[model samples]
Target: MIRILLVLILLLTPYHPNSITGSKDKLENQISTILSRIPSNTKTGILIYNPLTQDTIYSHNIFSPMIPASVTKVFTTATALSLMGKDYRFSTILFTDDSNIKDGTINGNLFLKGFGNATFSSEDLLHFIFKLKNLGIKEITGNIVGDDSYFDNIYYREDWIPDESANVKLPPISALVLDRNKTVSKRKRGRRTIYITENFKNPPLNIAQKFKQLIEENDISVNGVAKSGITPDNVLEIAESSVAITDLIAMINKHSDNFIAECLFKSIGAFYSGKQSNSFYSQQAIQEFIKKNNIYSINTEIVDGSGISRFDQVTVASVNGVLETMYFDLKNFESFYNSLSYAGVDGTLRNRLTDLPNGFSFRGKTGTLNSVIALTGYLMSDDKDELIITIMFEFSKGSWNFYRDIQDEIIKSLAELKKESSDF
Candidate 1:
């Protein structure tokens, strides 16, 4: 009878061969193996957290601040989405002090005013001019002036390297930007082709010149030259072009556009302070956001909106905190989540992590500088488990590919983690 009772007890006892602790241990081991491949001299910070269960799957030097590079966009975009709302739009307006239209002629200057629309291009300006023609405004006695006073006169941050000024990606930051402050000239030589790219020294003036060319092409006459100035209030609004903040954030985060990121950064400050936007006000606003969301980190510093400034630093913990806050924010979560570049999908991540198992994917933001590489985003599994992952490396030696490989290996191991089983 005792033997029979022992057999029954053994049969009734639950056998969980794949417990949560065991699964975590396996994950930790895999991650450690991957991390071991990293060069010892590299500064690294990593964190993986399960928001649903409030469990920290893994963490290493998560509080140490490192150069975030473009990963800073994650914070700038999230805060903009939260404060400005997803539907907010930045607009460029054509204002006229003289509204008199007698026989398709305007007597005064046409002021093209910009409110930090980063996507504004020559095409948009052409459309604005066409709208003027449609409105029977064929002649302007005054100049086609560009008004960019919405933001401060500083085109680029003081901390940025002076040599980066000519880079097309580091175009001049101005409220009035046309064609992203870039000029492309194409020429054909005997069976060969050459392209010349130049940055616009005066973006607003360039906008005015382009506007003048478009106006002349459309049979409109301008009596004066293109110039830059401030727009006076209470002017008659004639035409406008605008882009939604949602779209701006999408571009900024997915493509890591430094110019747009800077523009939107200033816009955030202008939105809150009701004053001309600048880096200082924008930094203050971002700090306010960190404080408000209780994600403050002593190591975190915001010198510019885009991580191009090497002075910008952030702790992995702070980045994870921002991700967590955005995850629970019901109103802005969808926009923020959808804006991230998907692994093996579109955006900068199009060619990355393509080997992820079926039904598993990652949506992340990538940051890279000469000596820094960072990736942070959500990793979703086939079992519906979501993990927030942040990995950053700052090294004096080694190529970006080496660090990227380590990051990819670590992610692959974490992707194998399953909520209900240790087998993964």
Candidate 2:
């Protein structure tokens, strides 16, 4: 009878070749094999977590500080959404000192005040013009002044590479950005046509100039030239153009737009302090957010919103912390999640991971610099389990493609994981 009982007990136990331990071991071995190919001096940090189970699936140098390139947008966007809310909007207002109009003329200067609307464009200016025409004002007797005092005068971060100044991605940061602070002009030389692209040294002044030209083109007249100055407190508001924070974050995350990212960063500082926004206040705001949420306990430095600054440093653990926190915040999670690029579908990842297995998907942000590459986001499997993964490689001496291949492989391996089975 005892022998019969023992045989029944043995038969009742289920066999799991892909048990938790076995599957975890397999994954670790696969990741280790991939890491072995990296150069000796390279810094690597990776962390994978199952949010539903609150289990850390894997970690490697997770707390080591590494340079994060464009991945910095993840933190910036998350913080902005948490504090500013999805309905927040940046406004550009037009004001005039003279409320009294005689025969469709303004007796005083017209002020174009910017509150760091990075999407402010010529179309918005046209709308302003239309509004002015409807107000029955065809001429301005005073100067068209540009007000950019919402943020500080510093245009570029000190740590940005000077050689990359001409890159469209590195356009000058300003409160009054027009067409993303880029100016393109056509030039003719030796019977051949060439185009010259340049960044505006003074974005506010350029905007004022463009506004003046547009006014003239629309059959209005300006007696004075375009100039930069402060908007008076007593001016009467004429018109306004605004963009929601939701759209701005999409540009920051999906396309990795540096200009918009920086604008939003400064806006965060301005929003909290009600003072002129600068790097000092902006960095303080981010640090306060980190402390309030207990995001990480490791050493990290955030020098700028866009990861273009060489001084920016973060760990995979910190990155994952932000991801997990945003995931649980019910109010803002949807906006935050939708801002990320979808793998194999849209945004920066449109051309990447196109061959992912059926029902496997990744929605995340990609960061890249000369020798740095990072990816962090949510990875969903066929079984409906969601995993947050962060992979960062800094100061690599090998080709970036090599490290990217390793990242893709790790993602593929994790995506193949089954919720109840260890088939991957």
Candidate 3:
């Protein structure tokens, strides 16, 4: 009876010596065929590596540097997660000189000092006011100062074009960002007409004035103007930001927010350099990180964290290295993986790969600049392999949709790879 049971088990199990290798070769062939269909004028870089098997399934121009666009955020956010833990939270403190007050009246300036909390919002101001009310502080006798001294004076990248600077998405990045350093106000010109626009000329002033309004609404009196100033030597902590660093990463990658990326980049610089952070210092910190991880590829250059700069470049192999590192680190794996835009689901990928029925989950970041498109992240194959894939294109002439379709087709072919069953 035991012999009979063992024979039945052997008959049911389907194992082959060459199945894994054959499937890998087949997947590589499909991907190569798809890449061959690309226009001759266009150049592409592709890499698909399986971390579990320690296998390089396919590589095309993998070592050549290409424009990464916003896909560069994967490296930025990954380094941030490595340096700053998943639980790290930025704090925006309300400091006042008067520690002892009589009946909710402070006789000194109320300073709002920021530590690069990019997600800080106007509602947080109200919460601070509430905290002040609870602390028996009803009036501030001095200016409601906005202290953004945590960073340098540079607002935007020097290479950023005028048209790109004109965008609301690319606002003046400062340490103390309120409502993402921009505001939109509704105006009524006529009975049935409405107009809305952004107000982002001065981030500190915008935050100061809004904070004053919220304080007044909270029944607290402010008898002084709101302006930019440094925090005094001795002050009491009133309130701090409640958002976590992990969520800030999500805001940067999932939305491809150029503003937040710059702000967070400066924060990383400050954390590493132990000095007032600027974009240059941020770039230096990123360079140091790449060196520490041995991730630099040929001609790889970076000018900004968001990849909005046309100067930023990365090789497919380099991007895949970062992806693989994040995947292997168990402590940060969940946070880093979840921060990417999910295909057919949310973030920058909400409108892409919607009709594909691949039995896998695609979490990646999409990047698009004029004539350049990049997609990089992890693709869970139907065979339960975590595939690190990066597809980049620098076309002489082509629509973004054109390149995006090719990227999707290559991934579809990858997801469709399977091994033939062996008959007993």
lDDT of 2 by residue, 1-424 (tens): 4324534654585756457677888789888988898888988899989765567889999988888888988888888888888889999999999978656999889899989899998899999999989989988999999888998888887533334332335677778878888889999999999999899889789889989999989988999999999998888998999999888998999898888999888888888788998887888888877778889947777878888875688989889988988887778888888989998888887778776777888899999988889999998775556789999998648887788888988988766655335342
Q: Score every model by TM-score.
A: 0.90, 0.90, 0.88
Ranking of all predicted structures according to TM-score, beginning with the best and ending with the worst: 2, 1, 3
Q: 121-176 in candidate 1: lDDT tens per residue?
A: 88888888778888887788988899888887788765343334322357788888
Looking at candidate 2, the ten consecutive residues that score lowest on lDDT are: 159-168
* lDDT of all predictions: 0.84, 0.83, 0.79
Candidate 2 global lDDT = 0.83
- How displaced is residue 416 in candidate 1, in Å? 1.5
Candidate 3 lDDT, 326-380, residue by residue in tens: 8767788899888899888899998887765546778999898888899998877
Ranking by lDDT: 1, 2, 3
Q: Please, what's the RMSD in Å of model 1?
A: 7.3
| lDDT of candidate 3 at residue 336, scale 0 to 100 | 89
Give candidate 3 regions above 4 Å deviation.
Answer: 1-25, 159-169, 354-358, 418-424
1 versus 3: better lDDT goes to: 1
